[model samples]
Target: MSAPTEPSRTSDAPGRGPDPRAERSRAAALAAARDLLIEQGWSAVTHVAVAARSGVGRTTLYRHWPDASGLVRDVIAERISTAHTPPTGVLRDDLIRELDGLRRLLHDPVSDRGLRAVIERAGVDPVFARLKEALYREGSRVFRTVLDAAKARGELAADLDPDLAVDQLAGPLMYRRLLAGRAVTAEYVERVVDDFLAAHAPT
Candidate 1:
């Protein structure tokens, strides 16, 4: 008789706890894909090569991600979803806090570099552009919500267009980040908040 056969490994197996090894492999694959995108642009990223770089198997990667674009979408969402919502007390205070958060994010080397690369890639890739637009829309909605709250509280000019106001408030920060590559310092945030409030406050 043949020797007793070992149980086949599967997603549901007795005595098998959560697969920490597989989790690490997936994380490594995502990290490798992100690093490759940052270093070599999206055109050079490949699932097989990402697995090799990540020390994972091609089958493992394919098991986790249906395609390279899907993997990239996950990576982008993971990286960019860290944006925090500003508090909702006062309009000026909220804007100041939001700008401070922006400053912190802008100064982070990995995030800053990744954002610039993604933004540049968005110009050429429609999918990336759509992702960027979605991110912007979400952020804009948060700011508009805060502004609407402020309006209800009689803190802002009654006739202020929330969308346009958000644009004015955030445009300078984006310009500095994307064009000048300047650090978003506390003083910079304070100055912008002051200028914005002065211009938009109820008279």
Candidate 2:
């Protein structure tokens, strides 16, 4: 009889945690994909191009992402799911900080281009539209959390709607930047933050 066979190795097997080197390679590929998307549009992102830019092998990228859309979904999801809200204790200050970050992002050439590409693609592609919707919902959670905290602390009305509030705060900046082709100046960002707080914050 053959010697007792060992258990098949699987990702969930003991001592089989993810490889750090593979993680680094994945990070590099993601970074390269993000840069290429921003600089040359989504059309420029391919397994070979990402591998070339990231210094990883094309096969490695293919094993992970399978296709360009898979990579795009991840890149967009990574950006849209997390919003940084500085904890200042003061709701107004926090809103200002968040909006100020948005202002700066809109002003960045790379970020601006990437954002525009996502928006434009979403308009015409159902797949991208779904991804965009997911992003929007996730992004809304940031403002929702802030609003909930403010409500709990008696800084905002208990009935304040977070979704509507976020739209009011973020919609103008995006519209002005993408549709109106106008710069979201620092002053403009401050005004929106102030206006939203004035209208919604508890007296």
Candidate 3:
């Protein structure tokens, strides 16, 4: 005899709240908010706009995110991990890999514009400024983790400050993007990685 067919899985299972449909709606709204922010800056992100772009009702977007800044904050927070890279054995290789990951993130048109928009808004909005500060900290986590691994592998001094090292590595990229208006290409990332490692490598 043939075996009985298994029950189909769905969002409507008993005792399961808000199911897959709700989750998909929420994700769609977030994606729409991100795209809007990238395409038109922070000013473009609103309840009505996100609702229209996401194909959900304004009430639903408003229910989950009361303010546009809250939605923007969530988007940026979720994207902080996009540039993360796992540790490699060699310190230089690890640093280069991390920088390369960053370069890819910056090269992504959506992320590039989204980041610039937030930075511009942060200059004038205190709420956005706070979120930006938190974002910077979150964005630095991967670098710190890589630094810790380098130290463990005897490639960096035990007393080398992880925060300072991360600043050294990321500062130039930000300067080029925000101040100098230079393209952060793979070559630029390699140079930044090399210069930082030359100065910080364990003696």
Off by over 4 Å in 1: 1-18, 83-88, 121-126
Candidate 3 lDDT by residue in tens digits, 1-203:
11111111233468775566767877898899889878887778899899889997887677677677777766666665555656666777777787777677676666676678678888887767876676677677777887888888887877898888988888888778767877888788888888887787778
lDDT of each: 0.71, 0.73, 0.74
The reply for model 2, stretches above 4 Å from the true place, is: 1-14, 79-81, 86-89, 108-111, 123-127, 148-161, 198-203
lDDT tens digits by residue: candidate 1, 1-203: 11111211243256877466766776788789888877876655688779879988888777667567656755666666546565657777788777676677667654565567567778877766776776677656667778888888888898999878877877788889879877677888889878888888898
**How accurate locally is residue 65 in candidate 1, as Cα lDDT from 0 to 100?**
70
| C-alpha RMSD (angstroms) for model 3 | 7.8
lDDT value, residue 94 of candidate 2: 77
Enumerate residue pairs that collide in model 3: none
Instruction: Tell me the TM-score of model 2.
Output: 0.71
Worst 10 residues of 1 by lDDT: 1-10
lDDT of 3: 0.74
Error of 1 at 19 (Å): 3.5
Best by TM-score: 1
Q: After superposition, how far is residue 128 of candidate 1 from its true place, in Å?
A: 2.4
